[model samples]
Target chain A: MEPRPTAVRPPIHLRIADDIRMQIERGELPPGAAIPTLAEISERWSCGMNSARGAVALLRAQGLITSGRGKAPVVRIPPRRVIRSSERHQIEKDLALKPEAERGAIGEAETNLNMSIGAQRFSSQYDQVEAGPELAKVFGVEPTTLMLRRQWEATDPNTELRLSWSVSHIPLDIVKSNPALLDPNNEPWPGGTQHQLSTVGVEIMKMVDEVTARMPTTVEAQLWGLPEGVPLIFCRRISIDGDGRVIETSDADYPADRTELHFVTPLRPWPKRRQA
Target chain B: MEPRPTAVRPPIHLRIADDIRMQIERGELPPGAAIPTLAEISERWSCGMNSARGAVALLRAQGLITSGRGKAPVVRIPPRRVIRSSERHQIEKDLALKPEAERGAIGEAETNLNMSIGAQRFSSQYDQVEAGPELAKVFGVEPTTLMLRRQWEATDPNTELRLSWSVSHIPLDIVKSNPALLDPNNEPWPGGTQHQLSTVGVEIMKMVDEVTARMPTTVEAQLWGLPEGVPLIFCRRISIDGDGRVIETSDADYPADRTELHFVTPLRPWPKRRQA
Candidate 1:
């Protein structure tokens, strides 16, 4: 069906921006290619310089292009994506049962960032807080129960930007059995959290991952050095043990421009076909 | 951590915007609450109206607030999320083998939106195109192979916005045995694509879902009636048959403002502990 004739045309600046955006999307203006100069855009589109400037600003804000102060803008070159797959859940559980030596060689850092733990700047901070209503519901505990919160981060030494960030919450009663788990210095935590839980005789049998995305706050943008238009993907992982107890909930953020969350589902075959 | 005193201060407008963002994040300024008017903000911050306006624009750009021309701004109230889980792959495969009567009850509309197919303004358009290099790799076919492309949409009549949208591609040679598969009218096809493929002797044994997100184009925003700062989540589902040949690839988009992608991973228990 034809669009309504009464539909309003977009403002001049938006029209110019959308045209450039399409060029970028179609790869006519390839990644790292400089955007046309303001004069050229104004000449071609028959618009004022301010309109041309607005178009560029819109492109930058949408994260389709990048520029430094006083620098010419160019289409952004997408970052190489790092796959973070749901299959890692089983891998981590298997690592938990390995001897410490083998587990030591395959730390969380290696699996997540494909970098050795010793080569990156990693930090872990531990604290405890009363389980509020939200936490209580997830843990099936009283609101007064103390929950241990562990915030973990891995930063790129050269860029000083976070390579990974996640915070985990577990009812203190569940892990207090192992005092070693309470110490921050014990991390890089070989075999990571799964091993830590194994020491307390808790086994994780299920991990449910909930994923969503949102634009980052200004502070977050600065921290990640995110270009405009990029969204941050947030994943909340809930770990449940065989006894149907919620063991831990960890939330992590990934810059959407450079991350792919892959989930593989293998289906069961149908019952043997009846007489043909 | 305490030694970095050389950081530059953010601009006044940015600082104000960050403060309001923090309030919203902390739930102090709950969703749907009105943002302070420009006059009030200028008075409180001792800044000019232009500065206050800048702050509000930043908030809207970040998708934390919603405003209309000549209307006061308010914190954005998120829509109710509809979860699309990975477990549905198994469910769909199971449904493909059920009796036609049973399959009739569980159409794609019922599963994704919890709305009956009859309630939606649904559309399907079938076309054919040569497999491009990118799609060729996915389907493991020659670049010149003809592929049937089906675009499907379900719109909410009241909003006139799409409730669901997806495009699927399958090698024409694979499904040509069933001419009905190439016809658009056959859809809302009983049982969906899985059942359609079953008619051609294909059984999907695995599905790999790759998920990412990005800011929507202006056209997308207008079509979805999305407020500023909302991101669109994109999921590519690759369906592989029992012989390991990729049978179909479908790409779907969901607005992050009201959608959640969930993946459930069930882990196997570790080998039993050896004698201590």
Candidate 2:
């Protein structure tokens, strides 16, 4: 549908912003390259300084450019993304059945980062907490039921910037017998969570990842050191056992600008294929 | 780590906004209920009117409340999410082998929406377009090569709200002989794009979904009727044939607030059980 006639002539700032955006998309303006100065924009668009400033503000809000109080705006240098693939679910499970020494040789996060393990700092904390109302409903348990909460993080040692952060919850009754599982020291737990559950005789048959996104809260933005316009990708993964019981749930947040979630679905083959 | 003392004291407005947000999360302030009036907020928080107004503005920017000029602000009512599961890939492929009458009973969008077919309006437009540089790289074809573009939209018949919107592209040479495939009139086609490709000699072996998110442009937000803080989920699904050729790629967008993307990953069985 055609836009309203009155809106056809967009405000001068938007027109200016769109021109620069087009230039950026077409590669005339590459990442980390300085954007046109206000004076330059004003002259090119035949507009006032305020209009030029507004154009820059628009680009900043859309995450296309970055500018400090006095620094000139530049095309945003997109962060390198670490692809998190669904295939890892199987790979982790397969490693769970192997010998402990073999499993310890590879950490899931290390494989995901495709980096040397020494470059990152990892930490894990385990505690017992009451299942809150929201998680209680998901597990079909009482609100005050004991649940094991585990927090894990991997950070760049030098910068201390978070590379990964996630929290996991499991019913205490399910893993209390395995002393190793109760202690945070057992983590980097050879084979990850899938293997941890294996010790308690619970085999995770399927995993469902529910994905969504939202703007980070002020504190979260500060913690992650996120850029102005970036959003946080939220994922809640529920692992189901063979008996259809919810074995564990993990909540993770990834910086949207540098994370890509890849899901691969294998289609069933056609039977007695017919060709036209 | 504890926040610095100076940074610890957030402005009064943030504190007020957090209190209201907690109330919403705790279910004391239900969706669609009018938020406290400015006077009530000012009195209860022992703050000035400007602080109260600022609190309300913060909530609106976070997408927690909606306010019109004269009408009172109300807690935003989140829409019921329609879960789109990756499991449907195999299901659609399975249905393609069924009889025409049986295949006719099920439409891909109808199954995904879990709604009666009569409630939504579906449309499809088909046209031949040049494979632009971006898509050409994906398909390993020349930029000027002919590609068939199909755009589909399903909307609520009464509300005219979009239920689903997607665009699919495939090289014309892949299915040129199947004239029915090129016609938009044949859409809502018994089994879906996967089935249509079955008419020719192509069988989709795997589907890869690359997911990301971004704030929609002004035009996109208006088209989707999205609220201020709701981001759009962008998914690009690439279909690969048995020979590992990229056969088709479909791009779809879902509103973050009301749409949840579920990906189910089934892990391979352990070779042999190892007792801890």
Candidate 3:
């Protein structure tokens, strides 16, 4: 199909930005390589200094390059992405029954993080609070019902940057009998929440993860040490018991630049009647 | 646990912004309601006009409110999110076996879009291209291998705004036998790619979705008419055949403000020996 002509061409700044973007995608401008200076860009594109500056600003907003005071713009060095897979849910369940000696050798943190466990600072806080309206609706409980809230955080020991953080909530009535379940010191549990639930004779048969993304608040950005244009991925995982009751919900955030969530799904065979 | 006292308090602008955010979250300031004017905010917070302006800017950067050149800022009205669940892979496979009349009633676009099918304009473009280095590596094929690329888009007819878009690729050697598979006119093909591949004796048994996010470029923002601070969610779906070969790959983008991806995993029960 022939292309339709437009009334006006794209602005000079956009053309320059697009050209630079193509170079980056082609690997001609690799990561950590400084971009062309403003003078060079203006001469090459035959545009003014303002156009060259606009082009640089456009690239920064798209997260393709980084610019700071007294520094040349460089292709952004993308962070190493850690893959978080849904397959771990079943693995954790199976490990819950393993011998303590073998299970103790492997913690979920060690499996998920690239750094040594000793280099990270971990904290857990547990409290009993009334179920708020949002959580109460999910749990199908009264608004004033007691719920156990657990907050966990792992930070880099030297830089104090947040490595991982999450909050988990469970109905207090379900796990009250298991005193170990309410203790924060019991964290780094061998098999994670699945094993904790098993102690109460509750088994999680299904896990649902709902994923979304948003710009982080000012405080959150400060805590995560996020870059200027990055967003945060928000994931809420809900566990369901065998009898179809919602047992627990955990909410976590991952910096969008350095995390990838992988989900594997197996499909049923197509019916023979429609086989061509 | 009590929070320890800090050496210094947060800036006045942050306090003002936090208070307004609390009001929005508490429903005291509903969506689309005009935020306090600069004069009003200054008086209420006992701060200068610049501080009040800074507070509003903070809210805009966090995507909590909207501010334009001359208009007062208002609480952002969130778009309605459409949930796309991983379960649809099986649902599509099941639909492939149904009769044409029943299958025509549902399309992939209808399942993912918020608008009626009749109100949207759908287009599909088919082309033959060489598998590039990145794609060739994924397919474990030679770089010169011919691949069929299909671009699909659904747009609002009246506004020409993009509703949904995706690009899919399959090795041409695998599907060249069925001429119908290479034609764009054959789209709206009942049951989508799953059914089309079924005709070629290729059954997709497993699907892997890799999810990440980043800021959109200028062209994308213009096409989607997105607000100032929204990000784009990137998802790559890889389909594996019965032989465990990656057969098809599709790349999709969704506006972070109005899309939720849901994945459901059913875990296998522990061995009988471990069942307590």
Q: Return the candidate ranking by DockQ, descending.
A: 1, 3, 2
Report the Cα lDDT for candidate 1: 0.88
Q: What is the TM-score of chain A in candidate 2?
A: 0.92
Task: Give residue A152's error in model 2 in angstroms.
Answer: 1.5
Tens-digit lDDT track for model 3 on A27-50? 999999999999999999999999
Top TM-score: which candidate number?
A: 1
The TM-score of the first chain in every model comes to 0.93, 0.92, 0.90
Rank the candidate models, highest TM-score first.
1, 3, 2
Candidates in order have lDDT scores of 0.88, 0.85, 0.88
Pairs that collide, model 2:
none
- In Å, residue A240's CA in model 3 sits off its true spot by 0.5
The interface RMSD value for candidate 3 stands at 1.9
Error of 1 at A258 (Å): 0.5
Residues A1-276 of candidate 2 have per-residue lDDT tens digits of 643344467789988988998899889999999999999999999999999998897788667888566889899999888889888888878888888898899887776774578898888888999998999998989999999999988887665567788999999999999988998876678888888888888899888999998876655666677776677889999999878889899999988888899998877676674532
lDDT by residue (A1-276, candidate 1, tens digit) is: 655444788988899989999999789999999999999999999999999999998888778999667999988999888899889889988888777888788867676775666778988899999988887998899999998999988887766778889999999999999999998888767788988998898889989889999999888887787888899999999999998889999999999999999988889887788211
Model 2: per-residue Cα lDDT over B209-276, one tens digit each: 98988776655666677887677888999999989899999999988888889998876666564554
Show model 2 residue runs off by greater than 4 Å: A1-19, A36-56, A114-116, A273-276, B1-16, B36-55, B114-116, B142-144, B156-161, B273-276
Pick the DockQ winner. Answer: 1
